[model samples]
Each structure stands twice: as structure tokens, then as C-alpha cells.
Target: MEQVAVIGAGSWGTALAMVLANNQHNVNVWSHREDQVNEINHHHTNSKYLPDVKLPSNLVANADIQEAVENAKAILLVVPTKAIREVCRKLRPFINTNQTLIHASKGIEPETHKRISEMIEDELGEGVHDQLVVLSGPSHAEEVALKQPTTVTVSSYHLKSAEIAQDLFMNEHFRVYTNEDVVGVEIGGALKNIIALGAGISDGLGYGDNAKAALITRGLAEIARLGTQLNANPLTFAGLTGVGDLIVTCTSQHSRNWRAGNMLGRGYVLQDVLDQMGMVVEGVRTTKAAYQLSQKLNIPMPITEGLYELLFDEKDPKHVVDDLMNRGKTKELEDLSSFL
Candidate 1:
């Protein structure tokens, strides 16, 4: 059995740790909070994150960063996007080039506009990029922790590295697939959160399924536009990380982004909604980064712009929806050319 370290004690990280332990890997979960570490070690449950889920007995928790990565064969970086750089810097001192680094967190860095893999490379040096892999799809942490059947995709520039990651995470209950389009996978995973927020807002506004179905469909188009502009494979968007991830995140109550957007449509301010949610709504930050990226790349993303206005400028949600409804006509396949 290989020793694997899962950085972060959040739901996703914990659920993934469970998967690793289930595979008979010696999984060490690192949490910043001492109480959480104790709870996982003694109680075998992370009440703050996965309350009802029982963690595997072999799974251990640590408060020390060095001990977490020490002698580990693979490191799963599952922290939030905002914390990715800081965590990478701290983790760099312990990580070696031999170990595989797989990141499941999704978001484009706001100012640098770097993808998570790029951010890891920037912080840890380019030598780590070849070993970097991304795992993403429609699977939710809640469902995965319950051992529900879930599927995800792992992508990297190196097919061999991607395959190694595929072997590490795949199990009977959890199925894994490999792809070479790192850009497309990351872009699809990150941007889908923005659409999830819109989905929640649509439902919150009581606009019914028609409005939401439109938002989801058009949302995929703009996502493809910007992703293709970045040289991501357009066909990747048609796979699990693309349409599959979008469908689950935008429609499920388990989505934090959707819940946050729902509150916005229910007339709550951004600050209040964030305060109540007490977790990082990646879409809120991703929306800003994606909006700026679209402007910089000259990509037309009306839905992103609308959400940006509603989120940052305090534009009324109803008015934003109205504007989206009345936008100028265009061909449905306008963005499809980018793929060709």
C-alpha cells in the first residue's frame, strides 16, 4: 500500500481521503485546525465538513504540514483556489519531483489569470508541472463520501502521469477516466460554478425550468468560447468535465454556488449570503476572474457579464435576467467555429 497525503480537511478532501483509504492506501489528511484533526483521529468523523459520514479507520489526520507530505507517494491538493498558492508554497519544502501531485480544486486565479496547475507551477517551480494532474467531473463530495457510484476525469499534458492518477483514484464505487486536455477540463470545471449560481438564481426567481434550461445551454456555449480561446480542446467540453459537470452543479441542491445564487435571487446581498454560507463560493471569485478574462480575450460572455453585474455592482437580479432575455440575436453555432 502507498502512502498518500490529502491536503485540506474540507468535504471534498475528506471524501477523497476516504476513497484512498478504501483502496488500502495509507491516507494522511492534513487540516489547519487542531480540533478537526483530533475529531478525525478520535471520532473518525469530520463534523464541521462531513458530519454524518464515517471516515475510514485507517485514515489519519495531522496538524503538521511536513508530517503530512513526508514519505508520501502521491499528494492530493484539494484546498480552495484562494488558498492554493499559499498552500503550495508551504508544501513545496516537502514535496519531491518523484511524487505525483493531483489537484481537484477548480478556479482561475483572479489577477494572474492562471489555472490551478499554472499557479502550482509558478509557486513550486516549472519542474512540478510535468507531474501535475487535475481531477474533475460531476461528482459531489456528499455523494462520494456515502460511497455512491461516481465518475470523474483526470487530465494532464503527460498521458502517462494522467494514467497514474487514474489508477490511484479508481475503485468499484468511484470510476475514473483520463484525458489529455488539461485546459479544457480545468476551464469546464471552474466556469460551471458560475452557471450553477445562475441556475440557483433562476430557481430562486421562480422562473421555472425553461429559463434555467436556456441558461445552462447558453452557459455551455460561452464556456466553450472562452475555453477554446485559451487553446483548450473544444470536444473536452462535451465530455464529463463539461456538460456533465455543468448539469450536476447547476441543478443540484448540494452545490454551494447554486445555493449562493439562490440567495441572491431571493434578494439577499452578496456579503450577507457569503456570511451565512460560511464557506468559499468559488463561483463568486471565479465570476470576477472569468469576466476579466473574457474582456481581455475579447470573448463574448453575456451570462458571465450579467452575473458579474449582479454580484459585484449590485445590479438587480431581475433586471439582469431581463437583459439576458432581450440580448441581440445570433447563430447558435457562433462559438462552434473555435472548435474547428
Candidate 2:
């Protein structure tokens, strides 16, 4: 069995640790909170994140970052987008060659506009390029913790690394697929959260499934536009990490981005929604980054732009919706016609 270190003790990280432990791998879950570490070790529970879910006994917790990564064969970087650099810097000292690096976190870095993999490369310059893998798709931590069936994709510049990650996480209930389209996978995964927030806002505004379905459809188009502009394979957007992830995040109550957006639609201020959720809603931060990126890249992302206004510009949600509906019409396939 392999020794895997999950660098964050958040819901996703803990659930992944459980997956590793269930695969008979020894897992060390690292958290900055001493209480959280204690709870995982002594009580086998992370109540704050995954209520009523029992973690695997073999899955241990560590407050010491050094101890967690010192001997691990693989490391799962599952922290939020903002904390990736800090965590990678913390891991730099203990890392050596021939180690697998997998990042399950989703979101583009706000200021740098970098994908999670890019952030990792910047932080861990050496001994990471050959082993970097991105894990993403429709899977949720809560359901995965319950051992429910979930499918996901792992992508990498190095095909071997992607296949290795697939083996590490694949099981009867947790199916893993491998892809070489790292750009498409990362872009699709990150951008979908923004659309999910829009979906939440639509629901909160008392809009029905028709509205959300349109958001999901058009959101995929926007994501494909940006992703292809960034040199990703367009077909990847039709796969698991693309349309698959979009549907789940936009519809599921498990999505913090969607929940936060819902609150905003219900007339709660941005700060109030963030305060109530008490979690890092990646889409909120991602919207601003995406808005900036779209401008810089000369890509049209109307949905992201609208969400940016609603979230940061203090624009009314209804106005944003109205504006979206009233925008000039164009052939739906104009942007993606080249791919077809």
C-alpha cells in the first residue's frame, strides 16, 4: 500500500483520505487546526466538514506538515485556491524526486489568473513537472465519504502521471478516468463553479428549471470559448470535467458557490452570504479573476461578466438576469464553429 498525504483537512481532503485508506493505502491528513487533527485521530470524525461521516481508521491526521509529507509517496493538494501557494511552499522543503503530486482543488488563482496546476508548478518548481496530476469532475466529498458511486477525471501533461493517479483513486464506487487535456480539464472544472453560482442565483430569484437549464447550457459554451482560446481541446468540454461537472455543481445543494449565489439572489449582501456559508466559495473569487481573464484574452464570457457585476459591482441580480436575456443575439455556434 502507498502512503499518501492529503495536504488539507477540509471536506474534500478528508474524503479523499478516506478513499486512499479504503484502497488500503496509509493516508496522513494534515490540517492547521489542532482540534481538527485531534478529532480525526481520536474520534475518527471531522464534524465541521462532514457531519456523521466516519473516516477510515487507517487514515491519520497530522498538525505537522513536515511529518505528513516526509515519507509520503503521493501528495493530494486539496486546499482552496487561495492557500495553494502557501501549502506548496510548505511542502517544498520536505519533497524529493519520484513523488506523485495530485491537486483536487478547483479555481483559477485570482491575481495571477493561474490554474491550480500552474500555481503548483510556480511553487514547486522541481521534482513536480513529471508527476503533476489534476483530479476533477462531478464528485462531491459528502457523497464520496458515504462510499457512494462517483466518477471523476484525472489529467496531466504526462500521460503516465494521469494513469497513475487514476489507479490510485479508482475503485468500485469511485471510478476514475484519465485524460491528457490538462488545459480543458482545469478550465472546465474552474469555470463551472461560476456558472453554478449563477444557477443558484437563478433559483434564489424563484426562476425555474428552464432558467437553470439555459444557464448550464450557455455556461458550457462560455467555458469552451475561454478554454479553447487558452489552447485547450474543445471536445474535452463535452466530457466529464466539462458538461458533466457543470450540471452537478449548478444543481446540487452541496455546492458552496451555488449556495452563496442563491443567497445573493435572495437579496443578501456578498459579505452576508459569505459569512453565512463560512466556507471559501471559489466561484466568488473566480468570477473576478475570470472577468479579468476574459478581457485580457479577448474572450467573451457574458455569464462570468454578469456574475462579476452581481457579486462585486453590487448590481442587482434581477438587473443582471434581464441584461443577460436582452443581449444581442448571434448564431449560437459562431464561437465554436471551428471545432465543429
Candidate 3:
């Protein structure tokens, strides 16, 4: 069995550690919180994150970052987007070019508009870039921790690394697919959170499924628009990380982004919603990054723009909806036609 290190103990990180453990990999999870470490080691449960789940007994938690990656064959970075740089810097001294580096976290860096892979590469250098892989799709931590059937895509600049990641996580219940389009995969994965927040806001406003359906569909177009501009394969947006992820994150109760958006829609302030949720809403930060990127790149992202205004500029959720509905008209497939 391979030894794996998961460098975060949040819900997603804990869930992934369980996956590795269940696959018979010796998995060590590192968390900054000692209390969380103690809980995982002694009780085998991360109550705060996965309240109803029992983590695999083989899954171990480490408070020490160095101890966690001591001899891991692969390392999975599952921290929030904002924490990625710090985590990578902490991991730098412990990591080598030999170990495969994979990140499951989604969201672009607000300052750099960089994907998680780029941020990791920046901190860890090009040696890690060659081995870097991204795990993304519609899979949720809640469902995956319960050993539910979940399929996800792993992508990398190097095909062999992607295949290695595929072998590392593939199992009866956790199916893995490999793709070479890292750009598409990362972009699709990150941008979907923004749309999910919009979807949540739409739902929170009690606009119903009809509004959500429109937001999701149009949101994919917006995502593809920016993704293609970044040199990603357009078809990738139609796959699991694209439409599939958008649909799941936007609709599922398990999505923190959606939940946060719902609260915002229901008339709660941004900080209050975040405080109440007690989790990092990646979408809020991502919305800012995306809004900035769209402005700089001159790409049109109406829903994202609306959400950004709602989250950051304190625009009324209903007014944001009105603004979206009042946007200039264009052919539905205008964006796709260029790609075709």
C-alpha cells in the first residue's frame, strides 16, 4: 500500500483521507488545530466537519506538518484557496520531487487569478509542477465519506502523473477518470463555485427552479467563455467538472457556497452569513477574483458580475436578479459558436 499525506483536516480533507484509508493506503492527515488532530486520532471522527460520519480507523491525523508528509508517496492539498500558499510554504521543506502532489481544493487565487496548481507551483517550484494533479468534479465530501459512489476527474500537465493519481484513488465506490486538460479542469472546477453562489442566491430569493435552471445554463456559457479565453478545451466545460459540478454544487444542500448564497439572498449581510456558516465560502472570495478577471480580460460574466455586486457592493439580491434579467440580449449560442 502507498503512503499518502493529506495536508488539510477540513471536511473535504478528512473525507479524502478516509478515501485513501479505505483504499488501503496508509493515510496521514495534518491539521493546524491540535484539538482536531486529537479527535481524529483518538475518536476517529471529525465531528465539526463530518458530524454523522465515522472516519476510517486506519486514517491518522497529525498536528505536525512534517510528520504527516514524512514518507508519503503522494500528497493531497485540500485546504481552502486562501490558505493554499501558506500550506504549500509549510509543505515546501518536507516535500521532494519524488512525491506526487495533488490538490482537490477549487477556486482561483484572487490576487493572481491563478488556479490552485499555479499557486502550488509558485511556492513549491517547477519540480512539483510536473507531478501536480488536480482532483475535481461533482463529488461532495459528505457523500464520499459515506462510501457513496462518486466519480471525479484527475488532470495534470503530465499524463503519467494523472494516471498515477487515478490509480491512487480509484476504487469500487470512488471512481477516477484522467484528463490532460488541466486548464479546463481547473477553470471549470473553480468557476463553478461562483455560479453555485448565484444559484444559491436565486433560490434564497425564492425565485424557484426556473431561475436556477436559467442561471446554471447561462453560467456554463459564461464559464466556457472565460475558460476558452484561457486556452482550455471548450468541450471540457460540458463534462463532469463543468455542467456536472455546476448542477450539483448549485442544487445540493452540502455546498457551503450555495448555503452562504442562500443566506445572502434571505437578507443576511455577507459577514453575518459567513460567521453563521462557520466555514470558508470559497465563492465569496472567488467572486471577487472572477469579477476582477472578467474586467481585466473583458469577458462578459453577467451572473458572476451580479453576484459580485451582491456580495461585495451590497446590491440587493432582488435588484441583482433584476439587473441580470435586464441585461442586453444576445443569441443563446453566440459564445459556443466561436468554439465550434
Give the residue spans of candidate 3 off by over 4 A: none
Instruction: Give a tens-digit lDDT track for model 3, residues 161-256.
Output: 999999989999999999899999999999999999988888888888889999998899989999999999998998999998998999998999
Model 1: residue 187 alpha-carbon error in angstroms: 0.4
lDDT tens string, model 1, 123-188? 999898789999999999999999999999999988888988888889999999999999999999
lDDT of 2 by residue, 1-340 (tens): 9989999999999988898899999999999999999999999999999999988889999999999987888999999999999999999989887788999999998878999999999999945887899999998899999999999999999998888888888999999999899999999999999999999999999999999999999999999889988889999999999999999999999999889989988999999998899889999888988999999988888999999998888999999999999999788778555256
Candidate 3, poorest ten consecutive residues by summed lDDT: 331-340
Q: Once all C-alphas are superposed, what RMSD does model 2 give against the true structure?
A: 1.0
Comparing 2 with 3 on lDDT, the higher-scoring candidate is: 2
Between the candidate structures 1 and 3, which one is better when assessed by lDDT?
1
What's the TM-score of every candidate structure?
0.99, 0.98, 0.98
Q: Give the residue spans of candidate 2 off by over 4 A.
A: none
Residue 262 accuracy (lDDT) in model 3: 89
lDDT of 2: 0.91
